[model samples]
Target: MAQVKLSAAGERFFGTNVTPRSFEQWIAFLRLELKKTQRKRITASHNLHSIYLRHNNPDMAEFYARADDCFIDGMPVRRLFELFSSNAGFNHRFTLMDNLPQFLMAAQREKWRIYYLGSTEHVAQKSLERIRREYPNLDMHLHHGYIKDNAAVVDNINKHSPDILLLGMGMPLQERWLLENFEQLEFGWVVQAGATLDYFTGEQAKPPRWLSAAGLGWLYRLAHDPRRLARRYLFEPWWLIAPIYRHWRLQRQENGTPRT
Candidate 1:
């Protein structure tokens, strides 16, 4: 297996062991996999921890292995890549807010069944309606994001058998929920999409594409919700960045050396 060495929060996360393999590699992998398989799958990782290792949070560590395909989802990972090699730091692939919509559109074109599980009945129903309005041919079933009893949710999943399930609970919870119940899900994929409704329903807006590409998506997100996210951006990586930056520099040295 190919791997690229990465250091974060005094911990290390390896990459695909090839240069320039950014977020696109992930999307490419998913697009091809979805084309071939129909099995329970999840695409998730710790955003503040895995992606932003310098800004890592210990609480999120449990979700690492549980993530089917854990993407180091922050600019910190990207920055590490750029520092060590000639690769583009950011891949700008899928984020929960935007990715679900793109995938749903693709599902629509393919005439796939999509089940959305999150929010109240009214909320879930409204999301379904919004999606229908956006893509006329889209086939969507409302399992209702409301969870009075999870067994009932499991039953709906058994009955509809969705091609993809966009799970909308926040992090760790969503990931944990999928791990706990994937055995019973008849879906081909279980994507952990947090707060997708807020953005998808026009309740929030993403930044310009160029800004996202420049690893500025967090900046946009922070600008939108400063009170909620400022501390995360400011204090999360309080002490680890210096050492992490040094390790990242070491990667550059290793990459620059000529092999015998």
Candidate 2:
């Protein structure tokens, strides 16, 4: 397969390179990539947890560094990019939940095969059922994330040979799985789809438009599952302070400005 060339230029945030693409541009990029036969490509998204992981976890850092394309999925990340990046264009947060429907519709039209791997078996079943009802013509496949044999799962995926692979096994796990088996995977695009299936299945409540637009979606998620997210939302960000400060100083130096 010929390499599909696409321009996704951007500045580095902390240690991760992020492409500040608008929702439309992101969709367009995906469409173009899907149209071509190319080597395995993985799309990664960033948020506070991901940023923190990049700083602390070597495996996570390597995954981000090797990602084919990265986007801002968190409002805080988008805000930081606006503060740090000098180049100006649309810098929107591209969450899978917000964009999955449109992309799936496009997949339907294009006859692209999609394989989603994540969520509980129940949630996965529900999501598949919903997709069947809504998009009967769309070629979609699903497998729950709890797998005993990684190789067998890889074999199953290869058998399907999907055009797009939606991996939603959650942070480091999803990232780690791809990093480990990237060479074995046969797909045009591997999307980091964290918790998107849950949202799609209505297992998790979707935040209101105003809250998501106002950048308080984290707060809403925290309110819903405080025990699971308290540390991530409240304490993990504190760990990022030192790295963010160092990045700020480096940015200042690069721009020939005195560090305040």
Tens digits of per-residue lDDT for model 1, 56-96: 43334445444455554455555554454433333333355
Candidate 2, position 25, lDDT: 70
Worst 10 residues of 2 by lDDT: 1-10
* Candidate 1, run of 10 with poorest lDDT: 7-16
My TM-score estimates for the predictions, one after another, are 0.71, 0.92
Cα-lDDT of candidate 2:
0.82
Q: Which segments of model 2 are wrong by more than 4 Å?
A: 1-8, 256-260
* Pairs in steric clash, model 2: none
Pick by lDDT: which candidate is best? 2
The per-model lDDT (C-alpha) reads 0.59, 0.82
